[model samples]
Structure formats: structure tokens, C-alpha cells
Target: MANTKKDILTILGISIKPGESKEVNFDVANLHTSTPVNVPVIIERSKKPGPTVLFTAGIHGDEVNGVEIVRQIIAKGINKPKCGTTICIPVINVFGFINLKREFPDGRDLNRVFPGSSNGSLASRVAHKLIHEIIPHVDYIMDFHTGGSGRFNAPQIRIVEGERELNDLAKVFGAPFVLYSKHLNKSFRNTCAKLGKVMLLFEGGKSFHIDDLITNSGVNGVKRVLNHLDMLSSKFKVSVPKKDCILIKKSKWKRAKYSGMFKASATISSKVLKGDILGNITDPYGKFNYFVKADNSGYIINVNEAPIVYQGDALFHISTKLED
Candidate 1:
């Protein structure tokens, strides 16, 4: 038998031995206000060898709950591990985070740019770097997110339905719901899936703020997965019993027919029957209003919290029919 210790290092060439942590800065962009923006990475390696799991957050900068969740997990410390590595990238979109916006500085969605080109736009370059430098090294990945700004969502896990291994991992993540979403064009999850790595997307709360309940649920979810993988020593006692989750195969956004002050009778996580009143669109004054209702029987997975809206703005995202 041999006792082998693991050596942790960054893409920048800094060394991090077992029981040690370090921040690795990735160059994003250099501007008048600041030099190359850094993507902070927290690495925790165990003396024993195991699979590496990357926990990422802030892919859509305004989504802050996942950032808090990752921060808390790192703060708790990995006292010991049965095997492997856990790398935490709490903020992937540095520019979006600082501007409090959802997309990159160039107004591109980071999530939509994957396996990107090095000679392309800033967002593309970042995506390329991540794919080349990070994705290949990890066995498992958990990309954390929340609803975009002005929308609220129930805590849930998003995965492809037939990916049994991923679905099982989603259960270990313990979100209230697990959405069965197909691969989208150029999305990160799709890219990772193509590479044979099981990636789970945990979504909850809303952008730019922390919801303690959602945050706690996310942190526990990570631990539960780690325990399942035998990376952590302690067994994770699920604090909250798993809630019934609707498996959403397809979702449609209800866009605003006319722009005006909006009022909603339904909230996030509300279940609505066909023709049920969801809300009303009205002029700033008390007169001239139109009702918004569900066209199908389903669960309200996402709702716009912002009162102001424009024509064609997405108002509600519904998951048609529920899954037992």
C-alpha cells in the first residue's frame, strides 16, 4: 500500500498542496478602470485521490443565490475527504456581476456561448478558455443559477430526462423540483454532456440578492452529492424532505400583449388550471385593463416580478402538466 498526497495547482502555475486553498485569477479584459478582470477560483484538494467536481456560479451575473451557496460551501472547509477534488468558481461573469446585469458587457448571454472561439467576442473567448482549460479535467460539474433579474423561480434541478445518472444526481441535489429540459443550442450543460461529463443545473431564487432558504437548500444539495460520491467523510442528513417536483419537458413564455403596469394574482410555484387568471395588464391609471390567464393547465415555474413591461416581454413561464 502507498500513501499518496495530491498536489493542487492553477492554470496560472501557482501550487496549492493538500489542506491549502488559493485564488487563481483568469484574465478577462483590461480597461481604463481596472486591469485584466480576474475569475476567482477556490481549490480544495484532499490527500487521497478522487474525482474532481467543479461547482460554478454567476454564469448570469445577476443571479446571486448560487454565488452565496458556493461561498458558504467553501467557508465550511473540507476537513478531510475520501478522495478527489472540489473546485469552486463563485463568479464566472466578472463584468456582469460588477454592472449588476445578466449578460456580458457586450450584451451577450454567457450561457449561450459555449465551446467558443478564441478569435471571437469577449464572451466567446471566455467560454473557449473555460472549455479548454477547465472542462476536460473535471469528472462532474454543478453549474448553479437563479432566475434572471425581475423573475422568481422555485428551487429546482434541470437535467435531461433520460440521463439516469444525472437524474439520480439531481435527486441527491435535493431541489424541490427537477425539470427535464432538452439540450439547448450552444449551452454549457449541453457542451458538457457531449463530453461525457454529468452536469447538473440547480436553479432557484432571483438575481442580485440572496434568499436564505434557497441558499441553504443549494448548499445542502452540494453536500448531499459529495456524500453520494464518497468525497466527504460525514453523511449529509437532508434537512428538508424532498418536495414534489414537476418534470417540465417543455416550457413556454407568456409575453405581454401590451406594455403597462402589471398585477399578478399568481406567484412563482403557483399551479394554474386552463383559463385560470394569472394576472392583469393595466394602464398606469385605474381604467383600461386586460386579464392574463393560463392557456394550459400547469405549474407556474417562472414569473416576471418587475411591474413595468414592454410589448412581447416575457411575463410568465409555465410548465404544462405536472409529473408525478
Candidate 2:
């Protein structure tokens, strides 16, 4: 990716010069009560010009882990880069966030509508405004997310296969696992890719919950990336990852075979062999118990955490192939 350095950064119709700080409102609409909502876009620039990176989270309102990750980045002053610019948007779906839900007020997933039209649904309009007003100002993006309800994900980075630059950056971020995944149509990642913007999507923990381990993983990954770009402040130190990142090329979900109360014995990021006892599903009456086994030999990337599950619900996500 080329450096999108500018002497003057203009975002949301606000002009911020080098070495300036500004909090611009990214709010596109008001609440039902006619009250104004504040979806802040925090931008910090260094005196020296370099690359501009955006840190975004809360695309899904219930993904509090992602929101906490970005919150820590801003709280610790990490967003104040030593060079270039850093823009942080801790919550994108303000409607969902306010209601503690995942979709907009009209029940549309914001992630599904990208590059939206000016006269569209509330979610689509938000997407349209973000793509037009915010995306063009940054060269790189790190969007944080979490697994949907009841599934706990090990800290990982997701990117499309065969993109050398993205692969290298993912390595620099140094998460535990790097999953080679495809871009969904009309998603933020796809829209950014189409517009020639490089993005690294970070997924960790589970929705509606915040774990310190997950938060640290995300915050540390941001530091590593900033350090790699030579934008890290001298006050912060980047730590080397304890283990090498596992590059997963293919994976499959192991679903429950029976409806019952479930408990996972295998932990996230643990290596499991074929037919290993991953967890157990037990009937409410305790009359029967079914043990769930691994389908293949690989690392466990995601584990379902819901206490009660139905047959065919995904129990675990296991890696089937890895890159050498």
C-alpha cells in the first residue's frame, strides 16, 4: 500500500493540520426522541507526515470485546502516532449499540450493506456515509470484531488468500492464528478492497463480553503494527509474540449431534487430534450423555459456549489445513 500522506487531513468536512487532534462527529442521524447521537471519530496526527491508519470497532453493537480493544488504544494514548495519522472510531453502529443489539433500528446488519446509497435504509445510509466520507482519507485499516453470540474465538487475524502485503501485515500484527478467509460481498472488507484500501480484520473473544486476555491481544497487536510502521511512540514497548502464528488455510465446523446441555472440554487455541474428546452433550434428565469428538487433527479456533444447544449447531471450529 502506498503512503497516503497529506499536509492537511480533511475528514467529515473538518480540516486538521499536521500535529493536531480533533474529534469529529460521525453521526448520520438522530434518535427516535429527536436527541442527537454522538458517534465520535477521533483523529490524531503527528508533526511528521507518513501513513494514515484507521482503527475501527463496534460494527456490530454487541461486540463489546472489539469496542474495548479500540477503547484501550485511545485511552492509553496509542492513537497519538509518532508519525502520520491515526483515526479511531470505537462504535460504528450506534443504533445497535444504544439498544444492545447487533443490527440497526430497522433490523438490518450494517456489515452486509457497504458503499451504500444516499437514500437507503438507515444502516445503508450509515454505510454510504462511512465509505464516502471516511475511507478515502486512510491508506490502511484495522477493523476489530468478535465471533457472534455463544461462540468464543481465539485471537486471530482474517485475510483473503494470495495477498502478500496483507499476509505480511498480519504477521507483523502477530496474532496467534492467521485465518485465510474470503471477503463477503457488500461487506466493509470487500468495499475497501475494491477501493484499493488495505485492511486487516481482527477477530477475537465472543460478543457481549470483554476478556482482558482478548483485549490485551488486540491492544498488543495494534502496538506491533504501529511499531512495524515506525509510528509507535517511544513510551510504548512492543513485545515479541510467545509462539509463532499458525497460518490456517482450511477449516471446518464440528456440529453437535444431539440437542442437550453442552460443555466444552477443549480450550480455544489448543491442538486436537482426530476423534479426541472435545466436549460432551448431556440430557436434562442426566439419563444420557454424548461425547463430541474432533473431526480432524488441527488447532481449535472457536468453541461454542452456549449452555444449551440443538443438534446441528456448531460446537467447535477446527483447522484442517495449514500453510508451511
Clashing pairs in 1: 50-84
**TM-score to true structure, per model:** 0.89, 0.98
Q: Tell me how far the alpha carbon of residue 263 in candidate 1 is from the true structure, in angstroms, after superposition.
A: 1.6
RMSD of each: 3.1, 1.0
Clashing pairs in 2: none
Candidate 2 lDDT: 0.94
Over 1-324, each residue of candidate 1 has an lDDT whose tens digit, in order, gives 011336554554666676555677767677547766778777767767777888999888899888889888877764235577777888988788888888988899988999888999888988888887777767889988998857887888899878789878887777777888888989999898888888999988888779988888788888778888888766445355457445777778888999999877888877788899899999988887999988888788888888888889888888865555
**Candidate with maximal TM-score:** 2
Give the alpha-carbon lDDT of every model: 0.80, 0.94
**Model 2, stretches more than 4 Å misplaced?**
1-6
**Candidate 1 regions with alpha-carbon error over 4 angstroms:** 1-10, 15-20, 34-36, 78-82, 233-237, 240-242
Local accuracy of candidate 2 as per-residue lDDT tens digits, 176-209? 9999999999999999999999899999999989
Give lDDT for model 1.
0.80
Best by lDDT: 2
